[model samples]
Target: MARVVTKPDTLNQLNQDFEQQVLTVPVFLNSVPKCGTHLIRNIFRMFVPVNQQYHDTFIQIPVLRQHVGAFNYLQPKLSWGHLLFSDESAMALRKAQHLVVVRDPYDWVLARARFFLSDNFQGNLEHLKSGQINLEEILNMMIFGIHEKVPSLSDIYTHNAAAWLGTGTKLVRFEELKHHVQNLESDDAEQYFRELLSVLQLREFPTDWRERVRVGSDREQSGTYRDNLTNTAFTLPDQLPEQQRKLVDYAAPGLRNLLGYCD
Candidate 1:
């Protein structure tokens, strides 16, 4: 298994600051890897009681059966994972409200490459992080993937996001989530969150929702937040290069459009 080194967050301690509501149905925050998983998970943590939050592990296919209790509807919990679409996963989440988060493929390529090269990520690809590989090559590896070591952009998005599209899972775009978090005071942001939180089935949106969101979205609290990543040697381009952007399209045709990221 790949190891990710992230600092323990005080969100649990912070979670106590709010009057949390017990969930009636299990709420699963599913996402493509690197699609603001921590940011969304942390925000939901603030709204749910710590006792009801699944702290076991980030549930995935291989170890899913072991942690299937995270989706228990009777003793509801708030859980999150990079779960791919599968018979077992579909069955497990049958009684749970599932939210599948995704990012624009163009930006997702950049995010994936950035993390793979950071000190926080210790995996088989460490050889590529020796500064021997140039930025463009690393970005290409992110798009096409490393032979058997990493799954390609198409593979990840296909099973993780695309396949789950019509299944009753709520699609949450990372870009939209970030925008609302940045403008929480606006009426539009309020409506965005109201709908987002509706899956939780909270009796009523809490009065302190804004403050909870503010603390949960704090960049310092997320270990994987771009600026928080340590020892990222490459100076990645702000946007994917035009050629690489073309490569992304070829790698995952119509992905951006399907995910509502159309130009």
Candidate 2:
């Protein structure tokens, strides 16, 4: 794993002391990769009344002191990016009562595929084509949903979801959001989410929250990669060997499951 770069003189003692300071309810909105984290950030930005700083990546979440520097410095609340549930993050979540919004594994992987295929991550292209990983095969799982007790898309999704679900953390699913929003219920996805912000005591919700509803919606249409993710080839007896399957399974069960498979 890569390092969390920021550290100061007497860093260990300082962080230990800081962690003990009993931080007020801080919002540690972990923007999961390709999980409509953008929409979530936008929604939170609407509620937080004061100026805030945000990062383009997850590296900042674990080292809050270096970037956000405790909630006391924050005008209202700060939204952050995808972070693994390490002790530093756990401490922040404990302080803030962070709400985790999880997309069904299928959709999660599909969105990731779009981002993965985009130009920003060109460095990964060589590895993927070399079979160090296979982005195309993995994405098909996103067309459907994760299945239990079997080989699936990437294993990473399944394992990752299991970690999130298994933890005592509070998680809300994207499906619930989609159904509620599409049905136009009184307690729609937007409303459900706004309530979380309120629970975190965000006095102001962006009026634009309503507008995000339209911008956030996605429908799975036929033959449309932009809409419908084509089913992935997770049933890998057809192409992948046992060793390869196990490799992917061990490295990325949650990722696989997110693509809607159980390998």
Candidate 3:
């Protein structure tokens, strides 16, 4: 039997029933940088209907507020962003089903470094590209946020998971989701997606949509954090420059214990 490709319009028509689904408030998917923000966005794209307009980053959204007239009527909305939490953001999130994702900080930092080097990223790349700094110095700048007391691109890497998400946000580890989605061969794959759906209160995702999710795109280029350092000589401790190490120690206190990065 030939497989029929469903047109976007056809799929949108079929998904209209889900549009009217009851959600008491908007849905928010927020995360740490390099913590699978795109992964959740894909999930939302497949599961959420077209009529809904979800905000990816509340703060980044220009000139919008809690009582914005257009947003009030966009029922059952979903949003995702990489913004750090603040009192104002938290207050705005109170009315939404907010979720957060975190990864081992070491791994997050390493992946971010590679991503920073990519041509399309367009973030502050001069330091990473500079011939003067070794990988360790670059990692130090990223982890500690300063190289010689000047703020570096590594400033983005200083987020503490607990501090960023605060008290009310629900957290999921990046490894857990990556493991399940990337391993379709596993018998538990379906169960894992179901578990995610349940957690997010999204009851309408198409059952076979798992096969459509492009898990291949998620494969880590250098593999894990330690593997990312294979070409370089430094281990995790040696990765951070002396001053940067002190800054990291202060910035992410208890993060090592919290995220089980001890190994």
Candidate 4:
């Protein structure tokens, strides 16, 4: 664990006070890209309007404080981003009850591949605009840089899950949220949803909450990569490259074994 550099005067009281304040402060939801981030956001929208914030890198403390200070206070703020933990981000997390979502890295990679393939994806990167790249190429691009310009894929996904692994942060399983789909029409589903809300300390939802959630979710979005690759007669990788494998391990310790995705 790395030591968080803070002011000397507040060093002793910081951790204690941070833990106490987290429970009451707003929810800060963050996740690796294509990891059911929008699904969680949609669910939260039922209770409170989800505010969008895009801090793509490891932000410094003073700048992060200023960014957070500018958030709209008319409603409960839900600041989200695809950011990894750093001293600055850790400091920002202090003021909010943050939740991070993780998915099987294999699935996560596939989703990103599919996303970039879409013509609607407004990426300025050359690889993204071509639409001729394969899944393997996509993985290569993410791990190694694209033309040595954009940040590497590992730069983002490596230690991505680790960013939110510390104390006072909640981990939401993408699998659990997906399972909710099966029981969406049943009373047990409402109970499950309620349990989720309880975890976030949110208020009770309306009687028609399930319908609202369903309408908000894009059920067809999750497995697009599989469908696309199957149609093109492409095969999934037997194993990730050494660099990519390490990235996943760093982001999610023992993820394959934990998720039963290991060979």
Which whole-number lDDT from 0 to 100 does residue 238 have in model 3?
28
Order of all candidates by lDDT, from best down to worst? 1, 4, 3, 2
Better of 2 and 3 by TM-score: 3
Global local distance difference test of model 3? 0.54
Per model, state how many residue pairs clash.
0, 33, 2, 1
The TM-score of candidate 3 is: 0.67
**Which should have the higher TM-score, number 1 or number 2?**
1
Task: Provide the global lDDT of candidate 2 against the true structure.
Answer: 0.45
Error of 3 at 243 (Å): 13
Q: lDDT per residue, candidate 4, 17-123, as tens digits?
A: 22111222356667876678766765554454322223332233335665664233333355565557776676656656677777767666656555554543434
Higher-lDDT candidate of 1 and 4:
1
lDDT of 3 by residue, 1-263 (tens): 21211112233343443433344357667677667766665555455655564543333233336433322424657666655555556566666666777776666656656555443344445455655767766665566555444343334433324665457667778788878777866769777777666644654655555644442223332132233323332224424345654555566666656654565
Candidate 1 vs candidate 3: the TM-score winner is 1
Candidates in descending TM-score order? 1, 3, 4, 2
| Residue-level error in angstroms, candidate 1, position 27 | 0.4
User: TM-scores across all candidates?
Assistant: 0.99, 0.54, 0.67, 0.64
Better of 1 and 3 by lDDT: 1
10 residues in a row with least lDDT, candidate 3: 1-10
Clash pairs for candidate 1:
none
Clashes of 4: 1
After superposition, candidate 3 runs with Cα above 4 Å error: 1-24, 55-74, 147-160, 164-166, 185-187, 203-205, 212-251, 260-262
